[model samples]
Target: MVRWHVWIKEHEFLGKKGTSQDGFRDLLRASPTPKAVTGRNLSSEDLSKSSLQGRYEISRYAPVCLWEEDFSEVKQAFDDLRNRGIRDFRRHFEKHPEEILSFAGKVKINDVNEYTLELYQAKTKEDLLKGLEIVFSKQSYEVFKEELIALADGKTRFMSEAVNRTLNGEQIHILLSLAVPPGYKESLSRVIVCITDISAKQRKARELERIGEKYRKIFQNAIDAMFVADTETGIIMEANESAGKLLGMSTIQMVGMHFTEFHPKEEREAYRSIFEKHASRGRSLSDNLLVCQRNGRKIPVLFSSSIISLDGRNYIVGMFRRVLSPDHAQRHARAGKSLVTERKVSSHAKERLSGREREVLTLIAGGMSNRQMAEILCISEKTVETHRTRVMNKLNLHKTADLVRYAIASGFVS
Candidate 1:
């Protein structure tokens, strides 16, 4: 009778302890600092059911939690937990199996998702484009990609936030995440930006699209026979206004034609062979090409092709300008005449010197002193001077400075 009474009293005491909210508080107050402030509000995160490791193991005590004496009754109402795993009965009733599988991995998001950064001043969209242009416009994409990644890795001034005026006449914080993908530390840092206002992004995108459409209209109507060719295949994909005049067909018909069609009949094979060689090695090739005109007349043309990668495809942009030889020839003829005149003048100055004096004159023009010239020729400084003096008189150059200036103008220094 005494044992039965003691057991009944013990059960009643534990039942009351489990029912009280203050009971959990009392446990936390007892353990001064559980795991460096152990039983405190846990690492700020989404609510989960995992049993915490410290004094406050909420998952275990949840069964006897206030309104529910037995949580197992709420879930299984059957025997036990039985180490829930692959063959767990409670998990089998999940409405969508994939939804259960998704819980296996972390949600995986960048830390510090959004925050207010107090910039000294707010920047407009044009200001941002100017900064991006400094890296993208001059350098190739490959170089620019590496440069942005380097800046983000150092945590420099590249990544920052600012305030922007929202359409509602209020300021909102705009955040830019220069966050690397979790595992890709060595590759380029890709930024995923966040704006509090969704309408702002749509407005900017629409304005830019309008600008691109305007340029497209002009490109299609331009006078020059502009062709955007696939650099790898040499096939012309886009042809503009004057292409029809040259090919005796509309731009639609010429779209399927290869650039080799523009070559002369006999030189077609040889011309294509050289272009293939340059394209394979990623080199730009250009020459004065002869394109047979639509009227069966051969026209003299100057064509220049540059390799560009646009929309993830390599394209050869070819521009043709008619070469009026009378204009070009007159310019070339003048250039040739100047070349001969300079040569004659320089030749006359070189004539009044011995062979050894000419050697010293050549070295002096090459920006070498008497000592360097002597070292190169395996001769002494005194020997170099004797040669220099004789050459100076022959050239009427009294001062060394005058000799240098003459050498530059006469094309010897170059």
Candidate 2:
């Protein structure tokens, strides 16, 4: 690891450490909204306040070793443009009494050589630098460097707390947090530069909150109970208010409990198989075989799901609608689920089957016998059986009812 800067540790230049450091720096430099990562030009809706911590403090480390120091002992940053590159950077510190930097920069003049010490205050930055031209006549460079760092550190803390709470992707035009402390109370007399990426927990928390709100609207307003289960863990990740009512328990008592707990140990295997299939294959909406509810009642649930990302991990977001009585399907027709079901394709198995074979499968789902299908398609009964055999082999459906269900589910027919 080549040590280039005092604040930038040597590990930052190697393998995983390098990528991690780069990602973190990019994240901070990156806009907080989703659009930034997606490569979409950001509108005002997607914005976060990007600010500096405070006015810059330029300082040099005392007792500096050019080699082997992580440079954290003094809790300071360095000015390294003078060092120019890695080779020179190492020599500067190894030789002692020099500074190095990353993530921040300040103006420099040819004056203030390696051995001076000085410090002074000015009302404005312009005035400060302007006076530096003549005022150093009274001070040493070491004192000047310390006073500068202390002042800059004070500003850094305040700016860190200046928050940008983004709602959806709204454009934010707040103060630049650069070089400032977050608040008056948080002001520290001295602070070290923090350059790590530690913002995921907060950002992910906000994203999950947003998803909860979106799903809540649908679950609370929909005419059915909604349940979400984790495929890998087999735990109930989320369930809407109606889920408790459908499961025959109060909402408070039902949450934080596993879905499998309500089922017979034997039935869990079947449910797990289906869930894993959905998670791996990306099937969209599915309906009940059965999901046991509270009070030990097995209720038929119409299930639906979509793939979603949260906190940088993939999860299946789901909906569960109770498939009630005979009238429920009819009620759902008006509300949306039945109409959706009607569009199901019954012949997904025939998706890759030849046209002649598809004709046979469709006839089978339509309740036609082989002889009847052959007669209608103007083929011999033997040809109809051949097509049927091919269809079954491809779809792996040995039973007629399974063929009918597969067809209906994939919207194979109206």
Candidate 3:
């Protein structure tokens, strides 16, 4: 047996004692050949062995699960399979899925660290090695097949995510990093594998995906026209269904178009200035804006915008509310002047009005015209006009000011 021991100070067990009080300092300044052992020197093999032992010590105490595997047998098995005219391992494995487990059994587990045992809930190395199949999940076969292909192609390293299980049958998400050590690629005699637990990270990711899906559904089904744009580029990143309908375009068509493109070309520069001001100030509302539809018809809208940040980039979320008309301000002031009338809608007129007609009347009292009501109710302008006409005929109120007074006296809008 050959053994080596390094001591900082001479011990009594070696039957040796240092003369100087500072043994370390003296040793550093000593001759290459000490007088006590002048002819004896450490061999090259001894130094190499000691270096390997140091590395083994490091692996034993590492915090992560470390594995040392021998793949020479598996390599030979692959060679035999390839010689049998099996060029596509993936297709062959797919046809004979059970062969994957058979090949996995061929891989020899040379050694594993303490952390490996802990991670698999094994009390000892032997316990883990005895039931190796219990730790692998069904998904592991896919990852293993990829590793095999990488090995067949002479790749030096491979990395992937896989699902594993513990002895107690608890599933674990893990990231596996596998590599052939330098000079070992030809024989693949020594392969190193590292496994990191990523269960918590994957769980959080899944949770975020669910939350994002929920909000995405809400945004797509919103009642108001909404847009998300890049402030720097002025490009529309997102538009909801209501926005597409109001602008006479599909949601797909609205995306990637400039925000100013939806406005009148002659007034684009003015709208761009307002958009920049809204983006800079973080939040704004302007009712004097107009949006041009695909058919070249212009519609007045109340536009409100707020700045938002997502994934380190700033964006503007703008919402558009359709207004009564281009001359709505004058009509609104006129309606306000006649709201103090004592004339109330009769019960006969109230009963004659259908639900939709009454709804239109209420919206009219709220200062919405046919186009604006059509946008809000998601109906056509003709349908909204029909409802408005029915309400007027039922109430015997033809003027806009008379409808406003009647709606107020009837307690439809307060």
Clash pairs (backbone) in predicted model 1: 35-38
Off by over 4 Å in 2: 1-157, 160-215, 327-414
What would the per-residue lDDT of candidate 3 be over residues 144-185, giving only the tens digit for each residue?
Answer: 777777787787677777777788788887776776656567
Ranking by TM-score: 3, 1, 2
The digit string of per-residue lDDT tens for model 1 on 259-370 reads 8887678888987887777666655444556777656567665454556677898776665544444555445445434333433344676556654565555457556678
* Lowest summed lDDT window (length 10), candidate 3: 1-10
Worst 10 residues of 1 by lDDT: 1-10
Which candidate's TM-score is highest? 3
What digit string (tens of lDDT, one per residue) describes model 2 on residues 355-392? 55654555575577776555344458888888877877
- Worst lDDT run of 10 residues, candidate 2, spans 50-59
Native-to-model Cα distance after best TM-score fit, residue 408 in candidate 1, in Å: 33
In model 1, which runs have C-alpha deviations exceeding 4 angstroms? 1-196, 207-211, 214-218, 281-285, 325-414
Q: Order of all candidates by lDDT, from best down to worst?
A: 3, 1, 2
TM-score of 3: 0.65
